[model samples]
Target chain A: SAVISQKPSRDICQRGTSLTIQCQVDSQVTMMFWYRQQPGQSLTLIATANQGSEATYESGFVIDKFPISRPNLTFSTLTVSNMSPEDSSIYLCSFSGDGKQDTQYFGPGTRLTVL
Target chain B: AQTVTQSQPEMSVQEAETVTLSCTYDTSESDYYLFWYKQPPSRQMILVIRQEAYKQQNATENRFSVNFQKAAKSFSLKISDSQLGDAAMYFCAYRSRRGSNYKLTFGKGTLLTVNP
Candidate 1:
């Protein structure tokens, strides 16, 4: 199991502002993913942050609204751009130490409240 | 694409009793992984147990065990001697083992309330 730490465990922001959440892993991982859990909803995959490349987003999400940056194997960040009240949700980061196994370890999660 | 479904939204179990949470999945791929995660009031996701598709024997971790019925595409978690600490929201997840995607498809989750 890998230890994942996410910064800004929670934050309250204005509707038009943006918040950047950071995810740091204790060990180097091959694949890093971002997920969003809206109120009373299940966790949804936001994007896959690959090191040294553009993030691959899911069908319902886009890079413009959620920009991701992965400078290296152990660190990544997800930025919610031009936030709104509907964007209020818990953002979680996860990664797998062994690529083929597909067992992912998740962070504590960042609870974002957009006012 | 894979999807997971947890039928029960809420369930209550008496302490020292046994409880089972149902989970069903849809996937065309034969090789995959199934996981059970627990989220308490602190809102941290904790891995409870895992099941590999290729393994015939079910996975068990202490008081937590899984009944994996591959033919039925069902994976349920069984908690024996249920304790107060076992009360939490449990999520069932499925992952495809073939890709580098590492994306987990999760169910809506079942909130387990343990009565002491």
Candidate 2:
């Protein structure tokens, strides 16, 4: 399993401001993904951060709202833009190694609160 | 599209006893992967066990085990010797077996409480 860490473990921001969460992995990985979990709700995929190319956003999410950066295999960042109270949730970053479809590890998750 | 379902919203067990969290999924593909992830009160999710559809034998990890029924499309997690640490939210997840870009579809989750 890869050791993953997310900066700004918990944060409170103004409704109109933006906050960027950083995800760092101890080792290089092939696949990295972002997920959002609303309070008391199941997790939903936000996007897939691809190295070099643009991040693949999920249906309900758009690049304008949630921008991602994957400059390398071991690092990625997700920024919540134009934040709203609705964006208050836990954001998680996960990754899977090469040829390891059955194993994906999750980060500790960043808790965001917009007021 | 694949969908994972965890029917039990909540469950309870006595310390040293056993508990099973029910999970079912909707998928037409034969080859895939099923996983059980545990999230404690602290909300750090971790993989408990995983089962490959192509494998007939069920997967087990120490006290955690999975009953994967391919035909029935059922995957349940059985935790033996339940401990206080086992009290957490358990989520069932599914991923496609064929694709390189495999995104996980997760169930709502089942919260388990261990009574001392």
Q: What is the DockQ of each candidate?
A: 0.80, 0.84
- Interface DockQ of candidate 1: 0.80
CAPRI rating of model 1 = high
lDDT of 2 by residue, B21-71 (tens): 999999999899999999997788898998999999999999999888899
Q: lDDT per residue, candidate 2, A2-90, as tens digits?
A: 79999889999999999999999998898799999999999999999878899998899999999999999999999999999999999
Best by DockQ: 2
lDDT of 1 by residue, A16-50 (tens): 89999999998789889999999877889999988
Model 1 TM-score, all chains together: 0.96
Instruction: Show pairs that collide, candidate 2.
Output: none
**How well does candidate 2 reproduce the true complex, by DockQ?**
0.84
User: Each candidate: what lDDT?
Assistant: 0.92, 0.93
- What is candidate 1's lDDT per residue for B18-72, written digit by digit as tens? 9999999999999989999998877778889998999999999999999999999
**Displacement of the residue B63 alpha carbon in candidate 1, Å:** 0.7
